[model samples]
Target: MAGRQTRGRQRIPIQFIESQDDMYATFSKRRLGLYKKASELSTLCGVDIGLIIFSPTGNPYSFFSPGAEAIMERYRNPDQPVSGIPQFIDDHSRTQLVQLNQALDEVLEMKEQIKDREKQLDEADGIRPKGWWEHVPVESLNANQVLTWTTWFENVRTQIRTRKEELRNGAGTSAAPGSTR
Candidate 1:
């Protein structure tokens, strides 16, 4: 593999693997060894390297030093990219944005569930609690509790709407055609 051709004495091509089956076996072994070396380099020298691999069948694999996706994202854009400092910041910001979006989705789902639960509790107790908001302050909420409340609220709302429809229909009130609710 070291005998692979080079364009210049100083500039060596990092891609050492050939497409031949015998070469492929050597490549696989070397790739693992290379990854180990990369890990050592990052840990010892405090350098970040993003290693990407394409197998013989064209499957993809990767390793990231310290912060995984952040390192790759720093190199994702070439032409419009900044050097070093701001690049790392942008990578961190991008990672944070992804995590924020995931959390937002989870909250939205929880809200739906809370609406359902509120309705059910109202039905079961035959009363809506006065000062419910003051009783359960948002600041004291945990994620799991919020999700549970959301589920109950949504289910109860559905039940109330269904009951209201039943009452309206029984009183000979006609809903507009193709409108179930």
Candidate 2:
């Protein structure tokens, strides 16, 4: 059997290794090959791929394309590992706020029209308009109206300030705020 016209180099079929020792060796080699391919693909295509591999033996290996860590550092928890996804719920929330504000503007305009009609009715009846404060433009209102708006504007400003604070705190750290990358 020692190559006396016998099989010298038998070709093992390309199948998943089942034996523990063979599996481990194949896993290690294949893992390295995969990472090499990933690196090559990133370099050639100018793409970024974040890869995390855990061996059957519980060994962990990771590969990240260039600027991957820096990219992940932004907008992610510094202490936590990052996946290749963006936390976009906040963006959706901002869009919803904008839509809600537009809807609110429409509602306010309707309310102003109703108030105008009420004023006209009061004048026809020789009654003084219900309140003098209703005459001002929405943009140029007094402290009481400002106070009323404070309920809405205050929450928006607080949310903005909180995000700003988070950005400031996350800068330069692994928790760095990502810039839509």
Candidate 3:
């Protein structure tokens, strides 16, 4: 009775854990499993593969088939020449290109978001013009269409003046259209 164990090892549940220590331990174990699988795959297929991972604390861990330098050497362009020294410029260039592409995509997405927001703001504020000259083709415009467009411009100018007057009266604002003041 003195040396008898009360509880035997029970099966661990497979589910998400909330504890940080437990999660880190799980991550470490999985990482080892991944490295083992990668090694086995490379050996079985006689293929070169490199895997690099960064932990949450920014520590880097890498596994490469054959060796890291060997894989990296094979990755570079064979036709490229170096002046008696190994140059990693090609890898850096590729990394820079990937970063630039990601940045460009982000910028384009932001531009679209801004355009959508502007459209929504315009719609909410009732800022649409009654007519636009660009809608009619310049080469196809007849005499009557040209006259009508000119009249529309004059009406828009008048509306602009009235709006400016209202703004001036409300807040003593300046910079009215076609004004020196």
TM-score of 1: 0.32
Query: Per-prediction RMSD in angstroms?
Result: 20.8, 30.8, 19.5
| Candidate 1 structure quality by residue, lDDT tens digits, 135-156 | 7887799999889888867876
Output the worst ten-in-a-row residue range by lDDT, candidate 1.
4-13
Runs in model 3 deviating more than 4 A are 1-18, 78-181
> Candidate 3's residue-wise lDDT over 113-170, tens digit each?
9999999998976865543555567789899987987897788788788877878789
lDDT of 2 at 52: 84
Instruction: Give each model a TM-score.
Output: 0.32, 0.33, 0.34
Local distance difference test, each candidate: 0.71, 0.68, 0.72
TM-score, model 2 to reference: 0.33
Over 4 Å off, model 1: 1-20, 76-181
lDDT of 1: 0.71
lDDT agreement of model 2 with the native: 0.68
Relative to the unseen true structure, what is the C-alpha lDDT of residue 154 in candidate 3, on a scale of 0 to 100? Answer: 87
Off by over 4 Å in 2: 1-16, 71-181
* Alpha-carbon RMSD, candidate 2: 30.8
